[model samples]
Target: MASTVVVIGGGYGGISVAKALDDIADVVLVEPRETFVHNVAALRAAVDPDWTERIFIPYDGLLTRGTVLRDSAVRVRPTAVELRSGTRIVADYIVLATGTRSPYPAKLDVEQAADGAAKLRATRAELARADRVLLLGAGPVGLEFAGEIKSAWPDKAVTVVDPAADLVSGRFPDEFRAELRRQLGELGVELVLGTSLRELPGTDPGRTGGFTVTTGSGVEITADIWFPCYGAAIDTDYLGPELRPARRADGRITVTTDLRLPGQHTVFAVGDVTALPELKMARAAQAHAQVVAENIRTLLQGGGTLASYRPEEDAIVLPLGPKGGVTYASEVGVLGAGPSADLKGGLFLDMYLELLGAVVAR
Candidate 1:
C-alpha cells in the first residue's frame, strides 16, 4: 500500500507539497477556505475589483489523485489529524503549513472566496468615498496598501504612521530606504514614522467617516478613512499537547534543517508556521514545500537520503501600484521601479493560476 500523507492547511506551502506527492502517496490536503486566496495580489484587489475575481482560485483542479478536504483541523497528533467535524485522518506522515493571518485588504479575513471578494468590493466602494486616508502601520502591507491607494486615487491624501523609526526596518540598505521614500514622495504619500496613534480612530477601518486622531508625539491628523496594516500572527493554536511543545514562544513550530519536527521523523512543517529565520513570504513557503516534498519522497522510497532547506538570501519584489516599486536581492542588491513593476506588477496571478490549473482569462 502507498504511504498516506496528510497535509494540514492548503495555503501556498500546503498546496505545493500536496501536488508534488499526489502521484506517489495517498495525499490528503485539509483546508478551511473554499478557495485558495492569492493574497500577494490582495493589496491590488482592494483597489481594483478586476483583481478580486482573479485572486481566488478554486482547489478542484489542484490535485488529480489527492483529496482536498474542506474542513478545519481542530487538533493534530503525531500520526493522525482530528477535524472540527469529528473526522479523524490517519496518516503515515503529516505536514503542518497553516500560514499567518494579517489584517484585511492584506489578507481577507473571510473563509469563502465570494465573501472575501464582496468584502473587497465593499471596501473599495468605501475607499472611493474617502478623500483622505490614514494607514496605521508602515510595514510592507501598510506601504503596499498606501501604494495601491495612491495608484488608484492620486489626489487622495494618504498618510502612513508607524511607531517604527525607519521604513521597512533596517533589513535593507540605506540606499533602498532612501529610494522608497523618494518614490512615496513622488506619489504624494506622506510618511509619519517613529510615532503611533494616541488612540484608534472612532470610525472603523475601511469605513468612510471623518475622524481625527492624535499621534503619540501630539500630532493631530484628520482622515476620512483608516486601516490597520500590522499585527500578523501565525495560525498554530490547534496543535495538541503531544506536538505543542515544539512550538516557539512566537507560535512558530520548530523544525529541523530537513523541515521535519525534531525527534518526530514522520512529522514535518513548512511555510510561515516554521521557526525559520526568514521573511514570511509566499516564495519562501513554496521553497519549503519543495524541500519537504523531496524529503518525503525519499522516505517513501525506503529512505536513501533526506533533503534539507537553507534560508535564502534576503530578497523582496515589492510593488508600488503596478508600474512603480523596488526589487532587492543578494545578487543584485536593489533595482529601481521598472524592474520591480515588471517582476511583480501583475502580482504573478497568471503563474499561480497556472500552478493551480485554473484557466487564465485574457
Candidate 2:
C-alpha cells in the first residue's frame, strides 16, 4: 500500500507541506475553516473593507492528488485522525499543524470567509464612526493595526497601549527599534508603553461607544472605540493525553530536530503549534513545513538522514499598510518602508493565490 500522510490543519504550514507532497504521497489535509486565511493581512482587512475578500482563499485547487478533508480533528491517535463526526482517517504519517487564534479584526471568529469579511465590514463601520481609537497590546498585531487605521484615517487619533518598554526590543537591533518608533511618530500614533490599563473597557472591544479607561499610571483617556490586539490561543484540544503528552506547557508541541513528535516517527507537528522560542509568525511555520516535508520524504524512502530545523535568523517583513512598514534580514539588516512595502505590502494576495493554485478555501 502507498504511504498516507495526514496533515491536520490547512493553515500556512499545512497547506505548503500538503502541496509539496501532493503527488508523491497519499496526502490528506484535515481542517475546519472553509478557506485559508491570509492572517497577515487581517489588520489591513479591518481598515480597508475592499481588501477583506482577498484575505480568505479556498482550498479547492491546492492539491493535485492529495485529499482535502473539510472537517475538524477531534482526536489524533498514533496512526489515525478521528474527526468530530467520529470518522477515522488512518495514516502512515501525521502532521499536526493546527494554528492559533487572535482577537477579532486581527483574526475573525467565524469559519467561513464571507462571515469573516462581514465582521470586518461591520467593524469598519464602527471604526468610521469613532474618532478616538484605542488599541490594547503593542505586539506586531497592535502596531500593525494602528498603522493601518492611521493610514486609512490620518486624522483619527490612535493610541497604542503596551506593557513593554520598547518595541520588540532586545530581540532585534536598536536601529530596528528606533526606526519603528520613528515611523509611528511620523504616522501620528501615540505610544503609552511601560504601563497597562487599570481596568478593561466596560464595553466589548471592536464595538462602537463612548468610554473612558484608566491606566495603571492613573492617566485617564476616553475613546469611542477600542480593540484588543494581543493574545494568541493555540488550537490543540484534539490531542488526547497520549497525544497531548507531546505538547509543551504553553500548548505548543515538542518536536524532534527533524520536526517529528518525540518517540513517534509517524507523528509530526509544526506551525504555531510547535514549541519554538521564536515569535509565532507565518514565516517560521513555513520553515517548519520544509523540515517536516523532507523528514517525511526520507522516512517514506525507507529511512535516511532527516533534516534538522533551527530558528531562522531575525527576519521579519511587517507591513504598516499597503504602502509602508519595516523589515529585517541578515543580508540587509533592518530596512525602512521602501523595502518592507516592496516585499510584503504589494505581494500579499498574489503570493497566497500562487501558493494554493487559485483555490478557494473550500
Candidate 3:
C-alpha cells in the first residue's frame, strides 16, 4: 500500500506540496475553503471586479489520485489528524502549512470563494464612490493597496500613513526605498510617515463615509474611507499539546533546517507558520514546500538523506498596480518600475490558475 500523507491547510505551500506528492503518496489535503484564494492578486481584485472572479480558483482539479477534504483540522497528533467533522485520519507523514492571517482585501477572512468574491465586489463599489482614501500602514500591503486605488481611480486622493519613518524596513537598500517613493509620487500617492492616527476612523473599512482623524503629531486629515493594512498573525491553534510546545512566543512554529519539527521524523511545517528568518511571502512559502516535498519523497523511498533549506537574502517583487512598482533581489539589487510591472503587474494570476489546472472562461 502507498504511504498516506495528510497535508493540513490549502494555502500556497499546502497546495504545492500536495500536488507534488500526489503521484507518490496517498495525499489527503485537508482544508475548509471550497476554493484556493490567490491572495497575491487580492489587492488588484479589490480595485477591479474583473479580477475578483479570477483569483478564487476551484480545487477540483488539483489532484487526480489524491483526495481533497473540505474540512479543517481540530487537532493534530504525531501520526494522526483529528478533523472538525469528527473524522480521524491516520498518516505515515503529515505536513502543516497553515499560513498567517492579514487584513482584509489582502487576505479575506471568508471560507467560501463566492462569499469572498462578493465582499471584494462590494468593496470595489464602495471604492468607486469614495473620493479621498486613508490607508493606515506604509508596509507592502498598504503601498500596494494605495497603488491599486490610484490605478483604478487616479483622480481620487490616496494617502498612506504609517508610524514608521521609512518604508519597507529591514535589510532593503536605501535606493529601493527612494525608488518606491518616486513611483508612488508619480502616481500621486500622498505619504504621511513617522506618525499614525490618534484613533481609528469612525467609518468602517471598505465603506464610504466622511471622517476626520488626527495624527499623533497633531496633524488633521480627512478621508471618505480608511483601511488598516498591517498586522499578520500566524494560524496554528489546531496544534495539540504535544506539538504546541514547538511554537515560539511569536506564534511561529520551530523547525529544523530540513523543515521538520524538532526530534520528529514524520511531521513537518512550511510557509509563514514556520520559524524561518525570512519575509513571509508566497514565493518563500512555495520554496519551503519544495524542500519539504523533496525530503518527504526521499524518506518514503527508504534511504536518501533529507534536503535542507537555507533562508535566502531579503527579496521582494512589489507591484504598484498593473503598470508600476519595484523589484528587489539580493543578487541584483533593485530594479525600476518597468521590470516590477512586467514581473508581477498581473499578480501572477495566470501562473496560479495553470498550476491548479483551473479553467476560466476568458
Candidate 2 lDDT tens digits, 71-148: 989889889889987789888999999988888877778888888889889999999999999999887888889989
Off by more than 4 A, model 2: 359-362
lDDT of 3 by residue, 119-206 (tens): 9999999989999999989999999999999999999999999999999766898899999999999999999999988899998888
Q: List model 1 lDDT by residue over 200-298, tens digit each.
A: 999888999999999999899999999999987887888988888899998999999999888888899999899988888999999999999999999
- Report the error of model 3 at residue 10, Å: 0.6
Regions of model 3 farther than 4 Å from truth? none
RMSD vs true structure, all candidates: 1.0, 1.8, 0.9
lDDT of 2: 0.86
Q: Alpha-carbon error at 138 in model 2, in Å?
A: 1.0
How much is the lDDT of residue 245 in candidate 1? 84
Q: In angstroms, how far off is 308's CA in candidate 3?
A: 0.3
Ranking by lDDT, best first?
Answer: 3, 1, 2
Clashes of each: 0, 8, 0
The C-alpha lDDT values of all candidates are 0.90, 0.86, 0.92
